[model samples]
Target: MLRTLFSLVISAAVLAGAYVYTFGVPGSVAAYFGPQQAADSSAGAAPSGRGGGGQFGGRGGGRSTTVVLSPIEIQPYQDVLRAIGTATALRSTNVMAEVSGEVTAVNLEANQMVAAGDILIELEARNEALNLEIAEAELAYARETVARYEQLQTNGNSTVTGVALSEARLALSLAEAKAGLARVSLDNRTIRAPIAGRLGLSSMDVGDSLANGSLIVTIDNAEALIVEFELPERAIGILQPQQVVRAMTPTFVGRVFEGRVTSFDSRVDPVTRSVTVRARIENPDGLLWSGMTFSVELSQASAPLAMVASTAITWSQSGASIWIDNDGAALAVPVTILYRQDESVWLEVDLPEGTLVVTEGAQKLRDGAPITSADAPRGRNSAGDAAAPNARRDTAPRAGAPT
Candidate 1:
C-alpha cells in the first residue's frame, strides 16, 4: 500500500508539470507558486483599456502584444469615370447649288480648304449672261434718252414736253430694275462656301446637269473637335462647364487628347439614367477626324477620407474592422471601405486623422488587450516608462500641426 501511494504521487507531479509547460499555469496557481510573475505583470494587469475599467485587461500573464502602428492619414480620393463618345467637327455644312443648270466649272478639290463666300462651283449661265447684257444695253439707251430730254427741258425747249420727259424717266427706272434682276439671276448660277472649312469630294464635273439645291460638297471646320458622351446621372453634382476631360481613340494608339467640358444636357435620360455631355478639344493638326469613336475619361474627385495600410484591416463575422491603438490597448474599430488602391485603403470610419492603427501583429490582439508598438522608440513600456523591453516611443508630430 505504501509503494502504491508513492507511485501515484509521482504520477500526479509529472502531469502537473506537463500541464504548466504546455498551457501555462493559471493566475491563482502562479501566485501560489511565486511572486515574480505577478510583480512583472502588475502594471499590465490593470482594468481593460477597452471597457474603461474592467477585469479583462490583458492576455498571457498581462503581457502586451507587439505590433506595428501606423498613423491614419486624410487623403483625397478620385474615381475614374470612363465612357465612349463620338467626335464631330466644330462646324460642318453641306454646300449645294442654288439654281438648276449644267456644271460649267468645279473650283474645289477633295479636302480643299476654302474661305467663306469663296466660289466653289459654277453652272452654265450663258442665257442668263445674255439677258444681263441686253438689260444693260437697254439701261444705257434709256439713260441717254433721259439725258437728252432733261437737257432740252433745262434749255426751256418746247420740243420736249413735260409728259414726254416723265415717260422717259419711267422707262429709265424700269430699265434699272431689269438690270438688277438680270444680275441676281446670273449670280444664282454660282455656288459659294457658306463657311470657311475644308471641303469633301464632289461628283459634279464641267458638263454634269445639277438641279436647284443639289448637294455639291461637304465642308467641315475641323480646327477644333467636339466630343459627345454620356455619364451616369449620379455625377450631376460634380459635372460642370470647363471641367477637364481626356479622350483616346483606338486609331491614335497611345495618344491622348485633352479637352474641357462644354455643356451638359438639361435632363437625364429616363431609360439609361445618364446625362449627355459635350467637350471641345483643339485639333490644329487635324489628326482627329469627325465621326470617330473616342474613349472619354474624367477624374471625379471625392471628399477627403481616412486612409490606412491595407494590411491593417481585419475581418470578423460581424464585418470589416481594424485594430487601433487606443492609448496602450487594442481597440477594434469597424470601418467601411470606400476605395482601395495598391497598398492603401480609404476608410469611411469616424476615427479622427492621425489615430494610430496596428498594421502588423493585429491578428493576435483582442479588444482591451495591451499593445506595444514596434515602431515606438526602444526602452519604454506601455506606460511610457523605461521598463518593458519591447515598448515603443512615438516621435511623430500631432496631426494638423505644421511639419
Candidate 2:
C-alpha cells in the first residue's frame, strides 16, 4: 500500500513540471508556491509597472518577451535587366561586280580599309576601251562635217541645202549618245567601294572571271557597332531611346562596352512577346566586331524602400509584417516585400528610416505585447544605433535569462 502511494505522488510531480515548462507557471500559483524572491536582483532599478518575472507570470503586470532588435534602413531599389544580344557593324555590305568580265587587277588586300569611290578591283576592258575609241572617232567626224556644212551655208554655197545640214546635225546627236554609252560600259568594268569601310576576304585574282552581281568582297564600317537584343513586353514602358546600357563579350573577358538605346521594334513579337532593341556603341579601338555575341545589361532604379533583416519579418493570413518597438510594446506594422537579397529584404512601407524592429523572439509577440531586449544593456542594433524604450537598462543577470 505504501509503494502504490509513492508512485502516484511521483507521477503527479512529473506532470506538474511538464505543465510549468510548456505554458509557464500561473501567476498566483508561482507567487504562492514558488520562490518568494524577486526574479531580477536589480528589480528596484526597473521603471514602475515593469517586472522581471513576467515571462514566468509571477506577480507582474503582463508578460514581456525578450527579443533582439535591428534598425531598418532606407535603400534605393534598382532592377537590373540582362539579355543576350548580337553585334553587327553600323553599316555592312557584300561588294559585288556590276558587270561580267575577267578580273584584271585586285587593288585591295583582305581586311584593307577603303574610302568611298576607292577602286577595289579592275576587270578586263580591252574590248570596251576599243569601242569607246571608235565612238569618239565617229563623234569627231560627225562634228567636223556639221561645222563644215554650217560654214558653207553661212558662205552662201548652193550645195549646202537646209535639209542636208539638218541631217548632219542629227548624225552628230546620235554619235554623242553612242560615246556616252561606251564610257559608261568602260567605267562599269572597274569596281569601286560604294561606302567607306574595311574590306573582307576576296577570292578573286587577276585571272579570275567574275559574273555580274558576283560577290567580290565584304565591307563593314565598324567605327560604331550596333547590338541587337530582345526585351520582354513588361519592360516596354520603362525602356526609351537613349537609355544607358552596358554590354560584355565572352571573347574579351572583363571588358565592358557602354552604349545607348537607339531604337525599338514597332511591334512586339507575337510568338515571344518580346521587343527587339538596338544600341549603338562606339568602337574607337576596333576591339568589337560584327557577329560577336554580347551580354547586355540595363539598370532601372525605383523609389527608396525600407530594408530590414529577413529574420525580422513575420507572415500571417493577413499578410507580412514586422514587429516595431513602440515605447515598451510591440506594434505589428503591415508591409509589402519589394525585394529580397541574401539575408536582407526591402520592404515597401510607410515607416520612416531607422525604425527599431524585432529580429529575434518574434514568435512570442502579439500586437501591444510588452517586450525587452535580449542583447547587452548597451547593445547596438543592426543600423549601429540604440533603440528606445525596450532598450535594456540593467546589465545585471536575472534568473531564467536567455543565454
- Against the true structure, what is each candidate's TM-score? 0.74, 0.82
RMSD of each: 9.6, 6.1
lDDT of 2 at 252: 92
What would the per-residue lDDT of candidate 1 be over residues 1-403, giving only the tens digit for each residue? 9999999999999997665443334456655643544343443343222221112334323446567888999988887788999999999998767789888888878888899999988888899999999999999999999999999989999999989999999999999999999999999888889999898888888899999878889999989999999999877878889999999999988999999999999999999999999999999988888889999998877799999999999999999999987767778999999899899999999999889998987777788766767765643434464433211223465456699
Q: Write the per-residue lDDT of candidate 2 for residues 1-403, one digit (tens) a residue.
A: 9999999999999997665444444546545542423222122223313222334333224435568888889987777888999999999999877799888888879878899899989889999999999999999999999999999999999998999999999999999999999999999999999998888987889999899888889999999999999998877877988999999999999999899999999999999999999999999878788899999998888788899999998999999999988766678899999888789899989998878899987877766656666663533322233432222244554458886
Runs in model 1 deviating more than 4 A are 1-24, 35-55, 58-61, 66-68, 157-170, 302-304, 309-322, 332-354, 359-365, 372-403
Q: Provide the lDDT at 18 for model 1.
A: 62
Q: Which parts of model 2 have CA positions greater than 4 angstroms off?
A: 1-12, 19-24, 31-63, 145-166, 378-403
Model 1 earns a TM-score of 0.74
Worst 10 residues of 2 by lDDT: 39-48
